[model samples]
Target: MLNQLIHCSLNSGSPVTLTATEGLSSIAQHEDALLRHLFQGYQKWVRPVLNSSDTIKVYFGLKISQLVDV
Candidate 1:
């Protein structure tokens, strides 16, 4: 993906410039799908409230444009 972005950046008249956002959004959408996939299998182990078996709800989000170098 980085290579493709670089290629688009180097091309002066590429129609692909506007399409970059589509690529980026697709990546983000996949992240949402991945989270849903995880929750589908792992919700059983999560205890949002202790001492109870009540049904729980979870929400998730990502912090954009922030880099963490570990």
Candidate 2:
């Protein structure tokens, strides 16, 4: 599930990218283990996409605030 979301976030077109962002947001708000996994996946897969797109970066900036501390 997270792998698919990370793949979409990294490789899909704009519409899928938007949807994947929403999914990523949801996943990020999960328990610490899941959130940490998601971040690891992001660093490995989605970071390039996030780094290259200002829109994505902004969206993630807001969504990251929803991540609770472990």
Choose the strongest candidate by TM-score: 1
Per-model lDDT? 0.53, 0.42
**What global local distance difference test value does model 2 have?**
0.42
Candidate 2: the clashing residue pairs are: none
Clash totals in order: 0, 0
- In the range 33-59, model 2's lDDT, one tens digit per residue, is 444544553545445354555544344
lDDT of 1 at 24: 68
Clash count (model 2, backbone only): 0
Worst lDDT 10-window in candidate 2: 10-19
Residue runs of model 2 more than 4 Å from their true location after superposition: 1-30, 41-70
lDDT of 1 by residue, 1-70 (tens): 4423322332234232222334667768656754564455466665767768676677999887978999
Off by over 4 Å in 1: 1-22, 41-70
